[model samples]
Target chain A: MVLKHIRNLKNRFSSIVSRIFRKKRDIRIGLYGPVNSGKTTLANRICMDWLGEEMGSASVVPHETREIQTKEKVQIKSNGKSLTFNLVDTPGIATKIDFEDFLKFGLKKTEAKSRAKEATRGVIEAIKWLDRMDMVLVVLDSTKDPINQVNITILGNLDARNIPLLIVSNKADVRKSSTTKIRNAFPGYDVIGISAKTGQNMKDLYGSLLKKL
Target chain B: MNLKIKFIPYEKMKMDSFSDILRDVKENTIILIDAKLKPEEESEIIEKTMESVSEKFSGIELSSIDFAGEEEMNNFERFKNIIIERIIGKKRGMTIIGPAKIIHKIKKNPKELLLYM
Candidate 1:
């Protein structure tokens, strides 16, 4: 009986040591795309689906995300290991450097210029932070033409950096928006058309993300 | 084929103004708009215009062409080739080209077919 008890004790001790010594893996993911392409909506969906609570707000305004928003300590089970994610939502990439445009959004001229400058800095930050991310979700507006400068620029940057990308085409419920056009625009990238509002194709998105992870 | 086209530039009026342009484009014709606005602004405009257009032309089918900036000119051939390779023989529909630079290129090219928007 004493020998059996000692054997159990050894097993418990080794399990504790292994648990203590196990390496922890954390993945950084950036939700990036043009403004109003539903980055916040996608981020909120991810937080809600994975964490059982919404973490971000969706807005119809352009440049709704003025700063970098982060949701940390998100855990996912992949490859039989517990993987943590630091999901970041960044300001949308603008194609032009127009400060006057911000004035239409109700900001004063100086404030608009400052916001534009902040947005420019945010774009640089988003691009530079590409190296730190394990995977990127380049969101696109499905209800419009896919050959956008911002989307192309971001895609080019990701290509240059050799980062794996998953193109999330939002607003799939819009009838005239063609996902096929978007797919054709980006020749050799993994693209998925999903509606963040209706949760269409979100399961597939999750599955694709899991595969990438 | 009946083709309609619309063009909006970055330096011109606000991107939101393009929604009216999209509305003016004939049904079943391609609607193209400049994508050179600030990323967030462009996205917002596109989203709003798309929502309106979809509601107005519920059953009509349309094609759209978004233009990348001048920095992507070298890559233009690839885009044109893709359109030609994917669209030329299979579809004989209307082509709507937008973004000033792309429209300028299209106007210069041999495909000089004109329509109204």
Candidate 2:
């Protein structure tokens, strides 16, 4: 009876010590990419998986996210290990933002100009916030050619800063998706294909994200 | 040189100005204090502008002209005319001024003006 009591006390003490020693620091994970690359969709998927909520609204219009969106303290469980991180969903990054582009999308002149200005500022703000990121997920549309100036510039900046990153080839659910193109373009970075819209191959995404962490 | 000259392409800066006159200078820079602003907000905006500049040029120093004497204003006018005359790639230019330390750097390394945007 005494041995049994001692074993129980020892187990309780070890569990308490383990909890205290566990790494509870909230890692900051930033989602970065160009406009309409499904960044928000992937962010929503991750949020829903862990927090049961969505981060921001996604739309077919370019630069829908005109500001930086953040969701904090998201705990993701993968393969029996749990990781907690603050998710930072940044506005789309673009080299040039012209108001006339929005006119084709059926927006009024005033609204288009305002959106262009806001999106331009958002690009700058996203660049400024790069210094605060612990890890980054560069989302790319698998349907599009991975060879683009925006992708190169973003990756160059990340490489210059030596930030830990993963390339997520999103929208693999589409029949025309070709993640191999992305993998070939960026051979150095880890690329994982997943359908953020339909939650396809999410297990692989979670595992890869944990590896990044 | 009383003015520490730093050249900035207008597209490189990224902030919405609260001042009325400076609003039209979007995608360009004034480099001088030509707009009217409250003294309290003046210092804040000046610092913010300089901070944005520092993000481009790490070691550069920035300064503002509170009251441009006649000669200084005349010099500014001539420089502005020259910029308007031969604008490269139609790129707008703005400059910030400082004292001895900055003047020395500009004089020593003029090529630093063409750093990446």
Name the candidate that leads on TM-score: 2
lDDT string for model 1 (A105-188, tens) is 787988776666666566556654555666799999988777644576577666655567899989998888778888877767
lDDT of 1 by residue, B1-117 (tens): 444554544334342354555455424334543332232333333333333322123211222233322224467765775586455322222234332212322221122333222
Supply the global lDDT for candidate 2: 0.64
What 10-residue stretch in candidate 1 chain A is worst by lDDT? A15-24
Runs in model 1 lying further than 4 Å from the true structure: A1-25, A76-83, A108-111, B1-117
Segments in model 2 whose C-alpha atoms lie over 4 Å from true places = A1-25, B1-117
TM-score of candidate 1 to 2 decimals: 0.56
**DockQ-derived CAPRI band for the predicted complex in model 2:** incorrect
- Interface RMSD computed for candidate 2 is what? 16.7
State each model's CA lDDT, in order.
Answer: 0.60, 0.64
The B-chain TM-score of model 1 reads 0.34
TM-score of each: 0.56, 0.59
